[model samples]
Target: MMEKMNQDGALETEKSLKRNNVVRERRISGAVAPGAGAVFRSVHAMQSTLALGSSFESDHIWKLGCLDGSSPDTGKGKSQFKSSSITNKVCHGFHLVEGQSGHDMEDYHVAEYRKTKAHVLGLFAIFDGHLGDRVPTYLKDNLFNNILEEPSFWEDPKTAIKNAYRSTDKLILEKSMQLGPGGSTAVTAIVIDGKDLWVANVGDSRAVICRGGVADQLTVDHEPHSERRRIEKQGGFVTTLPGDVPRVNGQLAVARAFGDENLKAHLSSEPDVRQIRIDSSTQFVILASDGLWKVMNNQEAVDMVKHIKDPQAAAKRLTTEALARKSKDDISCIVIRFG
Candidate 1:
């Protein structure tokens, strides 16, 4: 049965401020392969320097970034690597968390959290790799910097988001001959200026928010099943015989992704961005990968965490529940409790 909120379950959880940050790196290094473009310079350092949701208000922000993720292996199948000093900072609130385990030895992770202003701003990101883990690792290290440094960031968050996704995807592909089959999926959420939020997704990872304890999925699952209607509308063919999860183009499960040179002609990495302003009705938020949603629905996740009264514990509980359900993919999650 699909997951959902139990009728009698009334979650009333309230957490003041609990933020977790994770950062690690990939040992695989030595400049972009052989002919990759001049490694895009670091654009923006993680801005833990700003107090986005601190003394000025009652908000909090936290994030977790995984440098080495579970993307596909490299050309020789020797895991991709990165310079020890390259920054691989990823993930943050906007209520979201992603963790990686069982990956090869070359990867690392890092995270940060802060509270300032009258509201909370959370940053959450997930980088799923392919061909080799290096591309995703590079994305984990530089995606945000690309976003923050974009000229449109402050003026037009949505356009900035679209631009960042394209620019980053192009950079990865342009350098792929050197990196070899280099690519990854990126999903990000920014809870800005306090009550407003912006979500951008490339690939299957997702972003879901809670309002008055009810979950409102902000990002769409870019899966074959989810896109069947649109796919048909676009003159694409799909077998709906229903056996196991739906597949796009008879291979991948997601309708879009980053750096799938083979799929780029048909698939897309361009993000679907959304801007939402918060009010008193807002409650909390959850951001996670397909591993979590594959086994649980938005409302079910919200229902379980709502009454917990502890954001961190609730986040873990959600992960555990997904595991028990036997989700095949690596699972990661983050929860942001609001005032």
Candidate 2:
């Protein structure tokens, strides 16, 4: 297995290196604005050649929204993750673009309250939970803030990301004891210094970039099978089954995530992170639950919204397309456009 990984590692590593960073799920509790009801809370950051509300006119992708899904109750929702986006102007014309979860609302919000910077970072995530709801809710509230708040982020991003992933997973596992049997699969994107986008994922939630009519994947879906292949070659059988149903070990469907105390050895809950540099050729980005990607190919999605003039419209269409394909999982998408 080590030999297989070494041979493919270059490819995987290159892919990982070309696009990599850190991002996840949590609990929430607190008072939100009066008009917001049953609405999941989201967070995002951005860097641009233009200012907010300004008619964007340039070659840079604008960091737009982060979209995510959560169940009102902690136990019955999708894996929670962050979905960040951007858009490309292409040949001519303007494009429309746009852009949460919760529980432990207070801690998450308080942490969010600390990131008072003025960048427009978006949140599009799906919190898929098993055993309980508390952990997802906690992620809905805090993970984003934690990623940025870490001291090592600016100096050693990969290290910072690894640390954050493990730390968050540990915290979720610990809290779940009191909160519920909660553990969550997540995908998150954060715009750093405005020039880069970071995606961190555990499980199957996916992040994809549309460039030149090709769906450029920004992150990989960690699964027991992927892990299994790696481990099996190393003289290991971490999971009882393979192929038909993917699991971190033999227990969960997600490859990385928060909580899952019992599945720790088989499933580390650590995330794979990547950083993306957006340019004019970059059309848009999508972040969604497994339900969406399970049914659609990356390039297919890019083609769906490629020439469309409005990102929000494209996002809606993309989600609709997935549903039309009979995707039974919850679907959420965030679309962003660059002028």
Count of clashing residue pairs in every prediction: 43, 57
Q: For candidate 1, give the lDDT of residue 33.
A: 27
Report lDDT (Cα) of residue 67, candidate 2: 24
TM-score of each: 0.63, 0.62
After superposition, the stretches of candidate 1 with alpha carbons farther than 4 Å from their true spots are 1-121, 225-242
> Which stretch of 10 consecutive residues in model 2 shows the poorest summed lDDT?
1-10
What's the TM for model 1?
Answer: 0.63
Q: Per-residue CA lDDT of candidate 2, range 101-149, in tens?
A: 1111111111111112333343344554445445656777767667767
Query: Which candidate achieves the best TM-score against the true structure?
Result: 1
lDDT against the true structure, per candidate, is 0.52, 0.50
Query: After superposition, which runs of candidate 2 have C-alpha atoms over 4 Å from their true positions?
Result: 1-124, 229-243
> By summed lDDT, which 10 consecutive residues of candidate 1 come out lowest?
70-79
